[model samples]
Target: MVALHRFVVLTTTLLLTSLAWGETSNPYLPRARLLLEELRYAEAARALDQARAQPGNARDTLLEILELQGVVAGMLQQPAKARTAFQTLLVLAPDYRLKGDYAPRVVTPFFEAKGWVGDKGAALRLEALPTSGADNLLTVQVKPDVLNLGRSVRFHQREAGAGWSEQEQPLTEGKASVARKATRVEWWAELLDERRAVLTSLGSDTSPLGALAPGAISATPAPLPAPAPVSPLPGKQPQVARAPGLPLRTVAYVSLGLAVGAGATGGFLGVRSNQDRARVVGAPVDEAGLTVGLTQREAFALDARARSQARWANILFGVAGAAAIAGGTLWVLGAPVNVSATPAGVVVGGAFP
Candidate 1:
């Protein structure tokens, strides 16, 4: 009778354990779906977390968790978190697109993130122009803007021996140039996230650096020789030879670029400020009709922000103008001054008498 009792107890324990496992092993999809319907966003997020915590969840199941997490975070106004979640999704499937059922606001940020890291996107045309007087020099122009601020544009040249020369520069104001003896040169760009990890790379267009003009024929010309020094005149004070200061020109160009950038920013801010003014005029209403999901206080705050931005833009424009004027003055007056290197460092003096 004791042995019989022991066998029955053991069987009951095994049955209970089996039932528990059966209930827990099932996926969490149903739970999450129910939570979403109730508009319990936080709870739904927690449900997805629970699903991820479980061992042996299928790949598809995990993917769905990420997707839902992004959607929830976006709805909650957590853009950074949503961006991170979508980034993971893109890593898994580069071409992944969110379902159409999701709202436009939620889906928009996802694609923008994808485009920043994805292979398919608009590419800028890079042209290599040979400067008028300099043969070994190639000026690279990436017109307009650098496309992405966080990206780096690298310039490379193929050596006569075997490999490429390691010389590169970041794309500043969408322009760069390289001087080298190599007959062949090319350029490529890379995109990196804040963590400094390379997210994507754009292949070099293979347009040779020696091409004189856009769509012109490619050619390999000999390296230009250095100009011979001019002889000093006899009897008079030996005049110091001077080349036009390039720093002045760079400052001028950079100032001009800044002016353009600042002007564009100011124009945008002015338009936005006007928009806010219009919104203020039509409180709770837009040109189309009644504006939904917005309040008067919110509109006022936006208008304030727009005003502040416009002010900042104007300040930057002022700085740009001043810098341009200063730079222009310097460039025009950048005739080389006299410098005599002595045993004690160096000394600057007025132009040769």
Candidate 2:
């Protein structure tokens, strides 16, 4: 009897230890977390694995098996396994934001994700944009994959060696044609600034640029030429820069000079006023006539300086206003002004906004 009791006790103890080792959450979880916080991922993962293996462990949503598995797998540099673990984690914890972790992977060659607009659990794929004109006819290709794009594009041709996005691929003899495919219709073409439109369910595809709409952008998949770079961003240049139609477009140079001189006038007024006050205060009352005369002269000088600054400001605005009207007139006559600003000052030499 004694022998049997001892044997039973030994077996029970061993079984308990094994069960503890396999439990989902060890009491030392906090300590393991501390280790993880200190960048001790390996040790923390080992601790977590032991905790998870404890037999007859209570189901703890806060410490799910998948959660522990993901952390362990991530620490092991097994990204594929880690993602599997995380997907399982999502099945258990649906409210969490795993999209941040998976967004980059979604658009890769290996990730074959899909969604459907009409059927439940169905997924859509990438689709190519349609083309009809000579500009896009040969350059555009239909992709077998349907990419749900609400992006719109306008039809425009960029001259070769300038900035055309849709380009001619080198064919047999000197003739080149734009290359395209089902997976990716890789071409770039100049967009009509006025025609560029976005296609969407809201149906905003009616832009003046033309029929091409967008959800995804069609690219050359190559660098555009540096000689004719893309247009600079709108509002990049100052308003004064775009105006070049006045009699005094040349006088923008004067406006810049005027602003600087106005600040100088303020400095001069301050300096002269202080010096004159001292001179009058130090002199005798017997020289009241001279003092008064000197004070009058100083006041007139200050007034003249202020007036000169104001007049310059007026001239600057007046000239700019005239330029705007004249530039518009020239633009209507098919001669546009491309006013440009330079570090030296405003330079009006473009063909215009």
Candidate 3:
């Protein structure tokens, strides 16, 4: 009986230790909350610091921590610190609101931070305008301009199946140009501070803007060769002779058919990718900062699958663009022409090669 009791006590001790360790591993945020409720403003501020130092905190977690840090600083009469915390939070989430009922001290600084952000126009936004004609240039405009911000815009671009390449440009003129050299291009822009930290962004790595280069239909056709010099005989009028080019009508039709099929497949895959991405984005997180209803491995697998499908969709779209260009070029080159001698002059029918 003594031995059994000792074993039971040891097991209970070990179990409690394990639970305590698990809680402490991610307890900073919750501890800060409790400290705030108990009016331990200084201790809550320290807890918020620890929480921020912890890596891999979710966006929601960071937001909560920032708000709490701002409140604690305000309660402690640190106006500058409180304003800094609130400003960082506002930059990350422009529409974020303070949840609980706070004293005028806390609310006052938060609103002041809002006004500072507005005055500085710190809300960075990027907009991609549509290209016209056969221009292969993509124009990205920065909202409110960054010339006075003492910051630069960084652009991340990549072709399908290729790694990302970054380009940093100072938006002195409020806009930058990206050359579209590939069939499918993925790109996103970020507003970077002096320390190269991201302040705000338009798109992200997982969700990038895609653009297709203009096809051959928008390109100017090559000029045809000058007609051979006609020889005039004593009694026979000058006659022009031309040999029919290889029949490309059939080949062009086949290429167009393939393009249609590939385009349809790409569209279907893109839809599936978006659906999977939505599911991953909408997954709920529990108090322990873990995704609910799905294991971590399952969530990772879903994300990987979504990325794979998106890549494949981009590849198919590229293939479709190439095929369509080929078909259009062939159709233009193979168009037949009819020539007839008339009293007025020689008349030509059909499209000019």
TM-score of each: 0.29, 0.21, 0.40
Candidates sorted on TM-score, descending: 3, 1, 2
Candidate 2 on 1-353: residue-level lDDT in tens?
99999889766754564354344234655445445545686887776665554533332423244455565555555546655555533432332332222212211101111101111222211122455443434222212112222122222233323333432222122112333322232233321111121111111123212233233365547677689666546557644433434534445445545545555655565565445434433333333222222343443344345445445545655655565555445444333355555545566554432
lDDT of 2: 0.39
Better by lDDT, candidate 2 or 1? 1
- Residue 60 of model 1 has an lDDT of 51
lDDT of 1 at 296: 38
> What is the TM-score (0 to 1) of candidate 1?
0.29
lDDT of 3 by residue, 1-353 (tens): 99999889766754564354233344577667766877998888898898877754544666777888998997887778999899887766666778766654566567667556655767656778788888887667766532343266677889988999988776556776767757678988776545444556668889999877777343457899999987554454444543353567778899999999999999999899878766655566557443356544554566567767877988999999999999988877776666756555777766656
> How much lDDT does candidate 3 score?
0.71
- Report how far off residue 289 is in candidate 2 (Å): 89
Tens-place lDDT per residue, model 1, 1-353, is: 99999889766754564353233342665566556656788988888777766654443555566777888776666767777777666664455656435543455446445544443333334455446744565556653222342333355556434555545555556665556544444544433323233333345435333323334346657689999997444433443545556665677677777777777777777688667655543444345443445453554466467557667767877876786687677667565666655544556765432
- Ranked by TM-score, the better of candidates 1 and 2 is 1
Q: Which is the leading candidate under lDDT?
A: 3
Ranking by lDDT: 3, 1, 2
Count residue pairs with overlapping backbones in model 3: 0
* Model 3 CA lDDT for position 116: 62
lDDT of each: 0.56, 0.39, 0.71
